[model samples]
Target chain A: MSSEGTQPLGRARPQETPAVAAPLLRRGMGNLATVAAHLVLMTWTVFVAFPFLWMVVTSFKTDQEIFFSPWRLPSALRWENFARAWTDASIGRYFLNSLIVVTGAMVLTLLCASMTAYALARFDFPGNRILYYCFLAGLMFPVFLALVPLFFVVRDLHLVGTFQGLIIVYTAYSLPFSIFFLHGFFRSLPGEVAEAAIVDGASPYRVFFDVMLPMAQPGLVAVGIFNFLGQWNQFILPLILMPNPDRYVLSQGLAFLAIQRGYESDWSALFAGLTITMLPTLIVYVFFQRRVQQGLTVGALKG
Target chain B: MHHHKYRLIIPFVLPSALIYGVFVLWPYAQALYFSLTRWRGFSRNRPFVGLDNFERMLDDRLFWNALEHNALMLVVLPSATVALSLLFSALIAQGGRGLRGAEIYRIVSFFPQVMSAVVIGVLWSFVFHPNIGVLNGFLRVIGLGSLQRTWLGDPQWVLWAIALVAVWSSVGFFMILFIAGMQSIPTDLYDAATVDGASRWRAFFGITLPLLRDHLQVAFVFMGLSALDLFALVQVMAENGGPSRAADVIARYMYDLAFNKSQFGYATAIGVVLLILSLVLSVLVVQLTQRERIEF
Candidate 1:
């Protein structure tokens, strides 16, 4: 929710009065428009949702049935396809590894981003503008630009092929956008609240934790969900950093199911693997859809 | 209070500053330094190659080709995607209220956003497969047989093919931003136009276009950066930017130089060039799109 008493809040909600007493010709035209809209929406929706639906359906069909009738729904639902995908492909282990990597990255990114955002927002220190611009520049710098040197840096620190290494890279990758989003939210907070707390003999730490942090909760949730989704679905960094089979995250592991040799092109198994991999992100999105959308739009438009 | 404020800023800022410095700032500085030296990665002694790497980059045909492809993408992908998304947003906006269909469209369009680029790349590869592929299959049924071509395998069409998929994947997300921007434009303007006997097209050009300028600029910047940094689809669709390096963006080029070729110094030079290009473009975009603050 936006801050209360900021503007005439009625602007947030569109009026919903139903139109009545339209002429017959106008009504007919309106009905035709509505039908056209639905037709267009449905056609595009099917196009968009087809791969996801196909992935689900293919995951259930037998391998023989996959190639024979790739488009047809399975005659019998085979839940065992998922079981095989989970066990034979070591997806379960990959899930845990991904969980570890995402969790570590999210925790560290949030902690650091929040502290950084709070400082930049609330304090008028020297070099504040310079510091803010530095973070903004990070947003524009493509991560690929850093890959060659980062590989050497990670190697020098002896962190390659480790969960810690992936976390560090992910955290560093995510910090710029995270800090950017949090900084906007913190800036929007009225300074009076923090000032009042400081005047009440509260230290900056106490004021940040006890006052500003609570106010910045929605922003934090937004940034956290964005980072979590990003880290969870990440393929590139894991592909390069975690070359060991044991260290593969879910995204890489699931992709391996589709690409690995010696395995028959089991469409069902690949679909099952993809479905399992996509579940966590889907759940997060469903729960915090609004915040995620807001975060994305704000991050883009504001930056 | 002032003294306490300085103390608070110190503790609050220190931790993040340290982490960011170590992981980001330091590594970036090192990347710049490495760009000037020929380090064989594992070798302890890195020869200071000076501008040799930069000079080589000037002559590297692949680098220029990749830059051309990136420029083409910057022109083609963002404009097409954003324009299409804006059109869709305007259509949906005009469809009036009680429209659950709009919600469905939003969800379906954004589904691709949730899927990883790798998965999308793999899935679309099958869709565009020449023989058993869906697109060709449809073309055959429609009697447009000659239009069927090997989308990814071809050197010429690979970039366009990949760009089409990228647009398809991203249009929904941008549409959402456009819709939000549309909503922010007060409906009274539309009402006023209607009362003045304005056509839908007239209202759109007069009211919608002007108000949506800020959102459009933002979408442009985001899509431009994303297009410039394209790698996942390039990696999956063509495996190595296809034959003759057709779909190679700067990111994939950087990856190949570092990981595939072990050309550390050359790769860093390429990376530095990309960084500079992105920075310059981003600044230009910001300057062009900067909106005067509106006091309501």
Candidate 2:
């Protein structure tokens, strides 16, 4: 920008009325430019959204219809593909596995992170500074680099291929960001209410649970949505740790279905499986769309 | 009384400390030791051979090939995604009042951000399918059939094709980020520029981009790290790292060595290399993109 031969912001004139001022990108008005921008945006909209739409549409078509008329609407709305994918393949089971692990991990991650964050934020104690920074450092380390030793650690603890193993590992991996974000939330709280509760003969735990916990809910929800997406969409960890066929998460199960699709050629069922995997995230994102984006962007900027 | 304070603090801090210690910290520490040993994963015959794996990796063709692919991605993904995202953000959120259909476009574009990488990889794999695939089918319909290729299967275009998908899925997320960054800048900065006869393009260069430099730097680091460790997408999209290892990356190759080939020691060496490269590259990115701070 400095090299672009333009007036710098310091040289910017005082604000003028909208009618007097030519707003950024609004001057030299051309219907052609606006139309061109809309055209390009629409093209990208299709590029991004069409794949998911086609996944849903193709799921309703029969194999012949899919192969011959890829763009045509399904000749019939055969719900059989959904049923077959759900029952015959393992999508249904994997969906439940993902649900269990992700929910379990989220609860634990929030619990440990909140308690730890509260202590680090509100107290002046020895080793607190060192411990907080230690937790924060986890955000930088690449998880896959630890894959080999991580597998061995899980195996030694007899948690090599179990749900509990995944729940704990996911929680541990989630702690750094959770603690970091929640520390800010906990620190920003007014101390008077917590002190008043403490003076009224409440223990620290009681004070935290009754007063402080409720106050930290917004931060919890933000980090909760953030961790939920990370855990649900997790792949490489489960690939190594949860090798048992029955315990496959949705991502793994979808990948398994895709590889098998090449042999079985049940393209419709594969589409159905992918569409099924997409549904829960779509619903969650739509519901908590604002919080999710805010949390993710904040995480990147802060971390 | 002094001990009583620790009584409360210890309980709160211990659980996180324990969980983080065993799972995240311990394994990372052990990886250093494991990288120097030669063993097949199961037994305890891990006799140490210091730096042998590193020596082997230095000479290994596959390691070099994979590193080259990662380097290529490191360059391509960030630049393409950033350039497209910056333009889209400006157009969509122009002067604090967007163009028509801006809301729908903003919401719809962010949809892919929520979908799992495996779903994206699987879905796009079909989109690039050669025969009845959407891409080839569209090409034929548009009378550009000669331009169609078996995108994933073709070695010449496999890496770029997959890179295109990465850019496709990620541009929206970064665009949203840029829009957020844009909103934080004082509106009068743009207004002032506009009132001074600066053209729209000139105002963007002088104001919007300079103010958005911080977000831009972070995005570059995030993208570069992703390029370094694109294991999940490549695993789901390409079979065995594509034809002749054209799409192979360091992380995927490391997975093959450890799990598939039983070369745990060698794989750990590659993983160590990956860890070092990521650390170095992120530092390099921040350093290269550094400019004189323009505090508003």
Off by over 4 Å in 2: A1-22, A25-29, B95-98, B292-296
Tens digits of per-residue lDDT for model 1, B96-154: 56344576687678777767787788777767766535677668777998898998888
lDDT of 2 by residue, A1-303 (tens): 222111122221112212222365465547777788789888899888888888899999999998999879998898999988897888999999999999999999999999999989988898999999999988888987799999989999999789999999999999999999899889989999999998898978898899999999988998999998999999989999988989999998888888887688988888888888888899898987766666676777777
Instruction: Please provide, for model 1 over A61-160, each residue's C-alpha lDDT reduced to its tens digit, 9 standing for 90 to 100.
Output: 8877765665567899999888877887787889999999999999989988998888898678899989888877777667766776677777788988
Q: Best DockQ goes to which candidate?
A: 2
Clashing pairs in 2: none
Candidate 1 RMSD to the real structure: 4.2
Top-lDDT candidate index: 2
Model 2, global lDDT: 0.84
CA lDDT for candidate 1: 0.75
**lDDT, candidate 2, B1-296, per-residue tens:** 56766777899999999999999999889999999999885788999999999999888999999999999999999999999999887776663333556766777887788777888999999899886589998898889989999999998988998899889988888877777666656667867887798877787888878778777887898899989988888897777899999999999999999999888888988889888988998888677657435232
- C-alpha RMSD for every candidate: 4.2, 4.4
